[model samples]
Target: MNVFYEEAGTFKVGAILADNNTSLQIEAVHGKRSKIKASAVLFRFDTPPLAEFMGHVQKIAEELDPNFLWECCAQEIEFASDALATDYFGHTPNPVEAAATLLLLQNAPMYFYKKGHGRYKAAPPDALKAALAGQERKRLLAEQQARYVEQLNQFILPEEFKPSLSQLLYKPDKNSTEWKALEIVCTEKKLSAVKLMEKCGAIPSSHDYHFNQFIWEFFPEGTGFGELESQPAVENIVDLPHADAAAFSIDDASTTEIDDAFSVTPLSFGSFRIGIHIAAPALGIPPESALDQLAATRLSTVYLPGNKITMLPDGVITRFTLAEQAICPVVSLYLEVSDDYTVTGIESRIELIKITANLRHNELEQHFNDDALSKGHLQHALSKELTFLWNFACKLEKLRGKSNDTNNDKIDYSFEINDEHVSIIERRRGSPIDKVVSELMIYVNTEWGRQLTDAGITGIFRSQMNGKVKMSTSPAPHQGLGVSQYAWSSSPMRRYVDLINQRQLIALLRNEPPPYSRDSNNLLIAMRDFETAYGIYGEFQRSMERYWCLRWLLQEKIQTINAQVIKENLVKLDHIPLVTRVASLPEIAPGAYVKLRLSEIDLLERTFHAEFLQKQDS
Candidate 1:
């Protein structure tokens, strides 16, 4: 006798070899033998062979429609498969027909649900319709994703992706169909998604990609000072006394936050009073004000190759910046120096100073360099003052016991962008123009740090020990700067830390209580947040500079380049601030120059491929 039975959720036909009361030894249709419980047997029949019976049931099951069967069944009721099969055929169903009916119901789980052995229940009409709709939606999405992949494989961007290009490039949802198609095509084509998209002309400008990614992460709301009401003009700003000396600032031509300026007044015999005036924004932006909160959150201005997001609003910066001919409110530091350039006395006060000129580094460096100073004459407007400050800066450097040897002799590259074209200008470190500005800023910062400590007030300081620089509320020596105590108070309009330090200094000078206490939570939090944000901003700037460097290479379109090996396989490209690794570098010593054949410049990934050519003999 052949028995059609369900075993472990699978239906099969087998021949009974040994009959027992509780169990039976049976051989399956393929002749394999097994023992099954009597309760597992659904029905037994004769005449038909086990294999033939199984084949007949499969054929019948294929002819059955699950939807038609579900519609025929009565809702809110359970019925046995054999009874349903008999009712459909208008007579008792054979073993094949009964098993075929069970198979159809089992395969269509969404249409019919199993209640027990040989029993079934039809799904509610509404639930079944919703499930069908979801399945259809998934099918349509699969079709769309296939189309996207097809287009991408042919190096064509689909029209649907244009709306979400930024999202697809920078931050993509992994579970999304667009990302899945992109991932598949990228792998198949052996290229990154960014490179593939660029090839399809989706990325109009690689520079925009880098910039927008930064803005998306750091300034999600966008880089605009929109609808924020500007604060009223600073009170008593013009009522302050106009100092006797005329001051001039030295900065890059593009600089807008003109923070620090200088003046030198000659005295009898060999004494002189040198004034270092800083733009005073802290007086206008009180702590916890709207502008103050904005600055605090940003911590510092975000600087890139050709653009910046100022920490303060444009109106506030213009009001406080020490522009030419403006009697600006300033925090002045006056130093009394002897003929030997030794600072005998120092004074700090709030005053008004007329900014006579805003010196551009491009113009000033030509006239105020070491060659010009040694000649003892410059025909420019600030020639005498510049010469005196250079001499005084040299003396100040000597007083710190810091030699020029500590200076890195490294090159500092500045980027200038106009009409999407980039020009990287190289400036030597430790130049006369750099020293004059750096030394005086250091002096003022050190003196103000000392003043804060003497007056028992708290200020944020930049300290270094064992070459590790950090920010802290407590005063510590900046070993690198060769200063006993260093507080950044020069660029209040640009840096939030400097703004806070300026407030403390102003309070100390006015004999008022300081805003941030020694162990204030706000002070510690600001230091922590500022350090993190500053590092992020610095990294972003370097990345953008690197991006522009790569663009410059492509713009110039010279395939052959020269690089000096810094170590092993890593080298710095000559004339540009780009460092990369050369896999083909053949075990060369550091500082050896090697010619390279450039290929495969990828701006999206900020990478390039280089092959080492013959080394050049110096």
Candidate 2:
């Protein structure tokens, strides 16, 4: 006898050889013998053959209409498969018909709900309707996904994806249908999503693509200032004494946050007093004010090639920047120097100084460089003042024990971007302008740091210990600057740490309690936050510079270029600030030159591929 039975929710046919009441010995359709419980059998019959039974039942099941079966059945009540088959066919049903009926009833979950072995109950009217609608929705979505995949694979951007292009390209939602289809297309084309989108004209500019990605990650709240106003203009403006000198600031032309300036006054008998005036934004932006909170969050002005996000609002920066001809509020540190260029007296004051000039590096370098200074004459406005400062800065450098620092000759590259085109200008480090600015700023920072320490006030200091630089609430030595202590009090317009230190210094000058104490939570948090944000901003700046370097390479359309080996397999391209690794590079020492043949450049990925050609003689 052939028996159709259910095992593990699947139906199978086997030939029964013996029956021992509750148990039976049977051979399956595949000729494997096994012991089975008689209760497991759903139906028994003498068949044409056991092997063909299931195949015939399955075929018959397919032809059976499940809806018709459900309609013929009673609702919300259990019925045996054989009984249902008999009711449907209008006759006593055979084993094949019964098994096929059971198969259809088991699979059509929306039409019927199973009760027990070979028995089922019909679903209610509403539940079945909802299930069928959901199934249809899924079918339609599958069709839409297929169409999207097809269009994207053919290098076409679907019209429906236009509104979501930026979100999809930068911050993708994995469960989104558009992203799902894009994922499939990218896999089929063996390309990245960015590359595939660019090929499909979905991305307008690779530069914008990268920029939007950064903005999305770092400035998710958007970079716009909106209508947010700075803290109400400083009230009860203090009556500050006017300094007896005219001051000038030297910075890059693009710099709007002029932090430090200098003034020179000839005193009696070959002695002069040089004043380093720092823009005092801290006086206007009080502690815990809106502007202060905003500066705390940003920590520093974010700089990139051709663009920046200012730490303070533009209006506030304009009010405080040391622009020419404005009597800007300043924190002045004056040093009386003898004819031998040794400091004789040091004094600090809160004052207003009329800014005489805002000297930019490009034009200033032509008149105040090493060659021109050695020639002992310059045909410029601040020649006398610059000449005196140059001599004074030399004495300061010698006093710091770095009179012959090699960093003087190192190259510093600046990028000038105009309407999407870029020009890279190279300037030597430690130039006359750099020395004058750096030495004076270092002097002020060191002096102010010492003042805070002597006054027994805790402030943020930059310390270098064991060749690593870090921020601390307590004063410590900065070995790199050759200073016992270094507090960045000179750039309140640019850096948050400087602003915080500036507040502390201002309170000290006023003989008031310091705003931040030795263990203030706000002070500690600012230190940690500033360090992290500053590092992130620095890395982002470098990445953008690299992006522009690659753009410059493509813009110039040069096929071959020379690169200097910074280390093994790592080379910096000549005439630009780009550094990349060459896999095929031969073993070469640092500073060795290599010629490379350009192979490929991927701006979206910010990467390039090159082949090492030959080593060049030094």
Candidate 3:
């Protein structure tokens, strides 16, 4: 075979013609052609078009190829007489495309390194505190100038500079009410507060509270949230989640204003029809299109802690929350598959109708966990159809929705914070029920991603790095649900792309203008970037979660839990290993191990859970 390739259309050293007929000689010809033939050839290839070449090669006597040698050596360098080129100066940002890349880097197999380069190790941790303390000092000064900055390295670098009892108390609060009030502002600007506050070594103050206030910034303002406005009075009304006419508990009732409902019925062969109802954000949102700016800016709703900051205001997520009773816009997807899980059809186009999604996660969790609630309240108008789908494929269903159940590995913490006013049962688990629910969600998300990919539409997608990211890389498989492509569109209340995807689908369904560019390549690139940004969001969410979950975990005092390796790297015990910790051994797999280092609590990066992993045999 005539092998061919292209490299700037030129050749340099080591290009000697092989065979006794070919003395070690080389020549260059530009725009000139010459006829050359090797001894008898078993393969003949047409001169490859310029665009399709992989570099040129001719079969002369194949015997002339260099002898294969695999040699091991220590500390060796090959100096070249030629000028070192730019391509050699820096490595190509090798795009990683799979989980194996991270696995190889973490394990550091012998093949990944040469004989002389030995592993690097450092003493047990003294991780990231000195730096955090400096940061803490800076943030405190900026949050409140009046409060004397405590410079609490203890909190900043908990292990190295453990806080004294006095330092734990928040006393003599920031003199400026502005600091306190702005702290209440649940927006990124509050970081300005973190930058200004966090002074260490301070005594207790009445204002002391876990930094929960920051979460409010992530959401739209909710003044009358969790409250229902009355149009008139109804009979035998009970209390609602939002409406509290306590005195009028005389006859308070919850109204079901959800617009559309889903009906799924399993048919012969492995096929199911899906009905997706969506509430109109424009209805609750003012000026009809007023949400456009926010929809674009947020691109998607951001969820943190128990709080959710939606792209649109309460007027949308709730009032417009998908429901069957109220008229709503919806998108329906019907899919056919064999038991082996092959997508067979694209059924209905994106159909929009008024729908209700208010049966939200909590409500659903309750339906399964609470016996007294009865399954009736959870049933849809299309109960039979929905049940058929659930029965046929609850675990196999691809339209379930996106969420992580208790199974998502995390450092477990629960605070029996039985204060005079507050009592709560904190839970951090990767339990059975959680896994079942989460897996169902995974099925739906992955299917949605597939739909978008097939349509060549631009949209946001989410994927977890199967392991650590290394210098040379590829987009690792999304390990969360064990799927190739996982994305979300169930909620457009905040995510801009949800709206984009919804609009695109709506267009496709309505036979209107195509909302997304059909340029598959560009869309894929955008999707990749969106996924990367989502990773950053995950990190930020994890950092904040550590702060809150930590408070609860600390109060619970139930130390020790098993954890799994989300990513790992062999590092000097001195460095930090970034991962969430859980109290149960089940939280982590037993035999699986990865390089790790114990880290001082750095609330910012949340590097508290990375304890060294001992080899199982050890």
Residue-wise C-alpha lDDT for candidate 2, range 1-618, written one tens digit per residue: 878888888887888899998988999877899988889999799975777888888899999998899899998789888899999988998888989998999899999998898888999999999999999988988899999999998899999899987789888899988899989988988999899999999888877887888888878878765554543436324788888898999999899999889999999999999999999888888788877787898889999889999888888888889999998888899999999989999999888899999999988998889898878877788887898898899999999988889888789999999999999999998999999999999999999999999999999999998899999988899988888999999999899999999889888988999999999998999999999999999999999999999889999997789999999899999999988899999899999999999867878899889889999999
Q: How many clashing pairs does model 2 include?
A: 0
TM-score of every model? Answer: 0.92, 0.91, 0.42
Q: Is candidate 1 or candidate 3 better by lDDT?
A: 1
Prediction 2 global C-alpha lDDT: 0.89
Task: Report the lDDT tens digits of candidate 3 across residue range 157-176.
Answer: 12322332222222324444
Candidate number achieving the greatest TM-score relative to the actual structure: 1
Ranking by lDDT: 2, 1, 3
Off by over 4 Å in 2: 6-9, 14-41, 48-52, 63-93, 109-134, 229-236
How good is model 3 by TM-score? 0.42
For model 1, how does the per-residue alpha-carbon lDDT over 519-595 read when each residue is reduced to its tens digit?
Answer: 88767888899999999999999999989999999989969999999999999999999999999999999989999
Worst lDDT run of 10 residues, candidate 3, spans 243-252
Residue 44 miss distance in model 2 (angstroms): 3.7
Q: Stretches of candidate 1 above 4 Å error?
A: 1-59, 71-79, 124-126, 229-239, 406-408
Clash count, one per candidate: 0, 0, 79
